[model samples]
Target: MPFASQPVRRVAAAEGIRASGHWPHTIPAVRQLLTDGLDLDPGVTFLVGENGAGKSTLVEAIAIAFGMSPEGGSTGARLTTRESESPLSRDLTLTRGAGSARWGFFLRAETMHGYYTYLEQNPGMRPDPQFHELSHGEGFLELLRSRFDSPGLYCLDEPESALSFSSSLALVGVLNELTAGGAQVLCATHSPVVCSLPGAAILEVGEWGIRRTTWEDLELVQNWKAYLQTPERYLRHVL
Candidate 1:
């Protein structure tokens, strides 16, 4: 695809930064990202990994680097509650596509509540979704329906947290619509259903860092398959 079509084309560490033994730097995925830049596809790109594998970290850094609020919202949002974000955004560099839409939004599952409250406090010209009055999953879908209309970079961190199986399917449909409209999406997710969006590039993050893989080949998919086929087979070990 043309460089002008996507929002962020690449992500790498800023020049003159050396990898260290810091918390995030020590993570293999972060180290690899700093050493070798990651190229994003024009449409949707899903980062899938086990918990603590740095997928969320990468998504958060990319969103912040692209000028979205750390707590979640559009580039213009100033939502801030706890300052627990890492310093990786400061060291990371995002290569913006020429003539692409500069606007973007970050839907961070953990902080959407705060972002909704922020929106209420700073009401804009647009009508509020009244997120506080809706259920968690309803609020998420409402936010997406309201804000995901524009063509820009949409970064989501574990957005399926509040969604059910059918709701996950709805999210996938929304994502398809977004990409079809020239939007770019970077999502960090553990849900097999959500990441199953057709044509989405899946990157597996693990001890080996990052590697492109197919949906059928994803560990997440295989594990879910096995667990569903015979839950006793896997649950025996944990139980």
Candidate 2:
């Protein structure tokens, strides 16, 4: 049977996020990625692109508009309002059928500290004493394992940042289980492991615009995969 695209159940933000005159505003031309009149595929949608490709930016804007915080989206990060002044704006009157009955996880890099505090604040949470309390990568995986359980919409930015070869596979396993059980997962990543979900749709956000492609078509993932798959060849070329 042929595959069908996941229909966007709901879209939280249709435009770019708001920014003050300084920090958020000075970064780049974000408001230009306004995703008006667009919809996400229903089950699992992957935002595949490079760091500054604006994939995360657009996701962050919609997430914030959906009541999430900024890109460093930690609860500790001061929750702010939309970018009413910024040229980029999200205009979404979510259809009750899609976004109304949903739970979500929006995990970004800069705001990981908020999640750290979240775990620490729990009654059972404990403060870490080791310099390697968890390797930076380990901590990132731990966050994924700990936070991603309930059924809802989840958007992740570079979840591969924390995983080793083995751990990346483990994270992929978690995502597979989650999607198999009916949760919606969206991730922006360089790890082929995480993007290996059986039926994931990859949207490549680039200088031009969004393009749907296969996971292997992603340069970062393919390059890394090639290096890992044939280290001696890469090593020989390197020397």
Pick the TM-score winner.
1
Worst 10 residues of 1 by lDDT: 1-10
lDDT (tens digit, per residue) of candidate 2 on 1-239: 02322223544333443344543333333423233334566667788777777666666655555455554333233433333322232444333233232556678765565555644544235444322367787777766666677666567777777678898888778877777766766677866777777777787766656677887787767888788888998898779
Off by over 4 Å in 2: 1-36, 71-100, 122-132, 225-239
Prediction-by-prediction clash tally? 0, 13
* lDDT for each residue of candidate 1 in 78-162, tens digit (9 for 90 to 100): 8887899989999899888989999999999999888888998999997887899999999999998899999999999999999
TM-score of each: 0.98, 0.69
Best by lDDT: 1
Report the C-alpha displacement of residue 169, candidate 1, in angstroms: 0.1
